[model samples]
Target: MSSFRVMRCQPLAREAGSVKKPLNHLLVSAFVYAGLGVASGLFYREFTKLNGFPEGAFTQLGLAHTHLLSLGFFPFLILLGLERAFTFSASRKRFGWFLGLYHAGVILTSAMLIVHGCLTVLGLESSAMISGIAGLGHMAITAAIIVLFLALRTAVRGVERPAAVAA
Candidate 1:
């Protein structure tokens, strides 16, 4: 009897969860990226001021701040706004792909930047291998952007056109 009750309630819980809210990975990830950007900015300033300012750390962190905000936070913010203005279709499989890919790009690119930045602060030179890795990260970012555009274009088509009004 207890097992039957558990099974019945479990489905109800899952059903409740499936009811979509206006928020999802895309919006949540945007806010997260925003927080990360702000955090990066704060760290950038702190590192720059430490020990009479480490020049390499200062420059790399500055680039990291802008990169995180612009490439990670800003794009997602725009996507969230678009989502609110035009609700995406409930079928979210592809949107999930877009979200996953975009985040992968963001994480990849940002992590490489941080690694490169740290190496610079440590007075290490970037070898060809390091440069290749950085380039790969940038490529992921570019590919993610392309995927997002494609996804948005397809989803936007479902939005009903405004009715024409006569003069």
Candidate 2:
């Protein structure tokens, strides 16, 4: 055991600068995902009103809403906030991977959900291919989430004190 004391950790020289490219990609992708979420909701509502809508189809479209917002909008929105607070470019490679995997997962999951929903509407049974694609999408999403957590966990710089606080 040791006496408690306040300590400071400084940002390194390389952990510098605001990067626009990643932020742009995050924002743009979020907007698109947001749109897809809204669109899926609309489709879900309309699809329900029609007779003989496959019961399973409802579940699939419902997931579109969930995955789009959670996988797409959620992470990007958090990253946008993080952008102002930390220099994520400090770990550019990791951040790039997070963005890539995340976007792909969001796209795949939502696309698969849409495909499944359409099949339900058409009264077609879900096939092996659809199930396989959905499974892969889920895996990608899980991987992306892990990457996001790891990237943020290590990349954050120690909090700097304000002049008033320091004084």
Candidate 3:
């Protein structure tokens, strides 16, 4: 009975179709980046006052924020924009595994790198750990980037091939 109620509360298939808007996603991503950038800059300034310089601690935090905002948030928005601009059919498809993988990679990598970098900077952890985290994060981000690139390429080809045939 409870399960039935939950199912009834869920959005209908048709309603779900209208929920994803590429432009809206882009705008939301832009807003998140802007907010995080401002917060990181302010935090850095505060840390400098307390430590007489931006401490390794603050730097790591700032870097994390920057990456989250720029690579994680902004790239997602950019991807959405590209999908719309290129009319990618996959964009219209349900939340796909590739999208999940891309986002998970971004979030997990960013978190690990940020925390490891911060701990190393604070002298609480070894440089080796930091390096390892950074390496892993880079690999994850690279994978995400590759996925996005492939998706974009597919979308563009779909658009271009039809136009070429028509001509």
Local distance difference test scores for all models: 0.64, 0.72, 0.56
Top candidate when judged by TM-score against the true structure: 2
Name every residue pair that clashes in candidate 1. Answer: none
Candidate 2 clash pair list: none
- Ten residues in a row with the worst lDDT in model 2? 8-17
TM-score of decoy 1: 0.72
Give stretches of model 3 more than 4 Å off.
Answer: 1-19, 54-62, 73-77, 89-98, 120-127, 160-167
TM-score against native, each model: 0.72, 0.75, 0.60
- How does residue 103 of candidate 1 score in lDDT? 73
Query: What TM-score number comes out for model 2?
Result: 0.75
Rate residue 6 of model 3 by lDDT: 19
State the displacement of the C-alpha of residue 103, model 2, in Å, after optimal TM-score superposition: 0.9
Backbone clashes under 3 angstroms, per model:
0, 0, 0
TM-score of 3: 0.60
Q: Tell how far residue 51 is off in model 3, in angstroms.
A: 3.4
Q: Residue-wise lDDT of candidate 1 within 16-120, one digit each (tens)?
A: 344345356566777888898888878766755663554453445467778888888788778766665544424366566666666777777777777766666
Candidate order by lDDT, decreasing, is 2, 1, 3
lDDT of 2 by residue, 1-167 (tens): 54554554433344223566667776887888898888888888777667456455446766788778877777678878776556564577877787777677778878888888777776779888987898887888789778877766776644444333332
